[model samples]
Target: MAKTKTQTATPAPHTRTRTHRALLAAQLSNSVGDGAFYVTSALYFSRIVGLSAPQIGAGLAVAWGIGSLAGVPLGHLADRRGPRGSAVLLALATSAAVASFLLIRSFVPFLLAAALYATAQSGLAAARQALLAGLVEPGARVGMLARLQATLNAGLAVGAALGGLALSLGTRRAYLAVFALDALGFLVCALLLRGLPPLPGAPAASGDEPRLVVLRDRPYAVLTLLNALLLLRLPLLSLALPLWIVQRTSAPGWTVSALFVLNTGAVMLFQVRAARSVTGLPEATRAVGRSGLVMLASCAVFALTAVGLGPWPTVAVLVLGAVLQVVAEMRHSAGSWQIGFALAPADRIGQYQGFYGTGVPLARTLGPLLVTTLLIGWGVPGWLVLGAVFLVAGLVTGPAVRWAEHVRSRAAAPAAGELVKAN
Candidate 1:
């Protein structure tokens, strides 16, 4: 992709239109429920539902795997039937799944409910993205996404606190209440979505075109894979860092909570600002490239924590690493939003967004095992290798995006000529 002319001035920051407010409200409502569930779900399953830890983990793994496969078809449904309706329906389905969890006692019932939950959530995400793309201007979509991210973190924080209260009580009633709250949140989300302005569905594909056209788009597939690789960072803080702190560093276990707080608080405060300058594809790619280098530096700093430093010194170094990591995270997120929306075919935005969104679940599913093995099992060398992986993935994103653009341009050329002749 040759450099496109950059905007000379920064655009005014995104203001909360009614649609924006509705979207943010829906996101916050559901995320709060999700946050509470995240903190309580494991114990709920073990203590209340009588499942073994291994059983819980295996069931969730299978659920998300199936969810990942279900996204594309569900997103295609959004394109054919309108995004707002699809999103609303999926939200209700998600609520139903959460409600079912209250009745699930056996492993098989838990697995089935979990799968439904995951699938509905995945489809809901894709439909929401498609709705965002339709309603928001191209230039402001990233800004809107940044705001949504901030709202999500805020809601999660509040939900986590509520979940902590439930954990303190440690009763079956308390656990059930958390699940009930989560289900209610999704119900509210659906109601909010129902009020949004409807968007027309995409036109049907011509007879010659495949029904699932995204499956055949090789360049976009490559882009999605590269993005997924960069997303390995998703589990680093959640899964890998706590283990690294406890086993590898002199830092106290409390440092894990501190790091989590730092991450969520920083994102809530700064994510929108970090995304302000990413006005177009060129800027977006540059931001992604910069994020890679920053992530590499953070990784290197983390590696230093294992060098027999005093506890305070390890904590200080870990804090610095975390700051760098969060900065990288914000920039990468901004750039990703830009690329994901810009490169997708306008008519097929629902399916394309669904496919692109798969990177999240993929990262979540595979990242823990991979990151833990590299960081915990291999030690310092693992950190360095992981940094290199991030660096390469970030650098490769530029080429992958350009390849996608080139293919899109080539595909559009004949269409333009045919229009010219018809005129």
Candidate 2:
């Protein structure tokens, strides 16, 4: 709250000359399906299809791993063929993959279905991000991203409620109905993309440009790695803290639900407002650095929960930690958006965004194991070490992004000289 007091005024979404109401509407529709499918996927496989827990888990792990690897290539495709058309085609393809689940039963079929779904989902995300980059001005990007996050939360709530209603019916037909609706949602999203302005394919860069620019950009790679670490904040809230409360802390179990509500509600209310002040690279990097400090403070507070306090005292500390982590998340996310966009070459944003997108699914894939091991295995010392990690990473972000900018400038200089000499 104190950090974002110096915000530049940004236009309201409705006021912009953009017809992104369709895009926002598409995100809302897609996210609702995501929430429902995610919540019901395991149940659908377990109860209706009769697959065991370990079977589904292994398949999903493999699928997500494969999908993460595909992001770079698929993103390159988007750059070559225009994100608008690629996004539409991929979204429709994803819809077909989702509907295929109705026939999957055993391990092999399930694995194939999961792989197809996961790959399409990852590609769609990269395409949509690239599409968004083409759709909105850079200055307004973070605010729009913030609004999308908020919309996702709202859609999740609605979809979760729908899933609950479906679950209460306890029939195979009921589960199938949810799956069908989720597929339909994607189809609708594809239709929505058809209405957006055409985004022309990016022209190939000069032969002097590195063949695989994103892969060779070492500084951006480091920045991507750091962002991956910061993304651990998600698993901390979703996976680790809940289990920690049950296993280690004296806090009442209800704090789990309460803390999640706090995190979600806070983001819904404050994320866009917080992102407003971060309109450029310098401010973006500072916000990223501050997020680390806030995260460190949050971790320290969470560690206090294990200090043999009464349940109420423990609950208070847990809530405070939750609040701080959410603030840290909002700050870091805004910074990430700014840096990611500003650093990418305008023509190859899709490829670069795909490269950056790898960090997220990779983090989601690995974070659960890492955080649980550190927090649950080493206890308070572990939490302190994690805080130090956040502090160091956050503080390093600005320098790293600036260094990346310098590298880009150096890379472009020779090309500029070549063109002048030819003239």
Candidate 3:
């Protein structure tokens, strides 16, 4: 007694296309409001709440580290149970954390709220990405991912602008309002996900696959490791770069906020075309490699900002660095997502997403400490060190990409399929 491929399969077209779009829109809304909180929170705590910059950075690093450890099990849970449930819980947790800002203005309470928010961020990211994979046609995943990222950056720009506006309002109440808006965004995102048709959970099929099986896939494994380094450079830019500008270049806090606005605004404008440029590329591995190169170049720009440029020149350098960072972010996000979707079994997307997502949060945990420490000890020289680390890490991962190319080539040869869209 034999089984047909179709009969043995779980299902085709697990959810409708519009459902995916709804999820993406919700994500964009959440990111726009949430993004502002991170950049501004550090500043607010340091300048307004009366903490030292180093102390604030250290606290964030510790909170992020704790959240990263928590994410693994949460990811696994999303895989076993369902992301819809997780998404709802995430929304609730975020709401509570944001509201807690009003009641407990101390450092310890802030740390607890930050940790909770980070955990929610990790869970939502994994669940949303995995859910999208289930809902979309496989060939369109990269484009969808880019669109998702572009939406997020756009939302971030809006959020940052609003936060800046709140600062101008000059009251604790305004700040609390901003946090409340962010919480509401999370709630909206959860509601949107809940309305979508059921996405397949990891346990329903291929229940025998162990978590470690993903690690055996060397190409993916290697890329995940390299991403750990890439993720570090961004926070350096987000947290450290602005601080550097304000302290060293005679710029105000507004100047730093303006620079971020430029960074995110550029992504919103150019991300679509950049995403399309590699869409028909031959191999996913090379596409991802190209993304690495873009990132390497951007890190160089960021490292040079500490050399004491005049105000406009400083802004220009910051803009250039931001441009490269966003470009690289767009490309890397697309390619990495493509890789995740391609490597995942149709049945267990949640588990794979959980494993894959560990890189970004883990990088966040480590990057701030490294960049802050370097900045304290050596200023501009520290950024050079950071840039070098990213460049070397990216180059070292090339061999694994080559492996992926070889594997994909074999898979495509027999079917003579059109090349999958490049990320």
Which candidate tops TM-score? 1
Give the distance in Å from residue 29's predicted Cα in candidate 1 to where it truly belongs.
Answer: 0.7
Task: Please write out the lDDT profile of model 1 over residues 107-165, one tens digit for every residue.
Answer: 99999999999999989998998888777877789999999999999999999999999
| lDDT of candidate 2 at residue 134, scale 0 to 100 | 79
Number of clashes in every candidate structure? 0, 0, 2
Candidate 1 off by > 4 Å: 1-16
lDDT of 3 by residue, 213-260 (tens): 555666766767876776776666666776677665644567766766
What overall lDDT goes with each candidate model? 0.90, 0.84, 0.67
- The TM-score that candidate 2 achieves is 0.92
| Clashes by residue pair, model 2 | none
Superposed on all Cα atoms, the candidates' RMSDs to the truth, in angstroms, are 4.2, 5.6, 5.9
Query: In model 3, which regions exceed 4 Å deviation?
Result: 1-17, 43-55, 105-108, 204-219, 246-255, 277-282, 299-318, 373-376, 379-384, 402-423
Output the worst ten-in-a-row residue range by lDDT, candidate 3.
Answer: 1-10
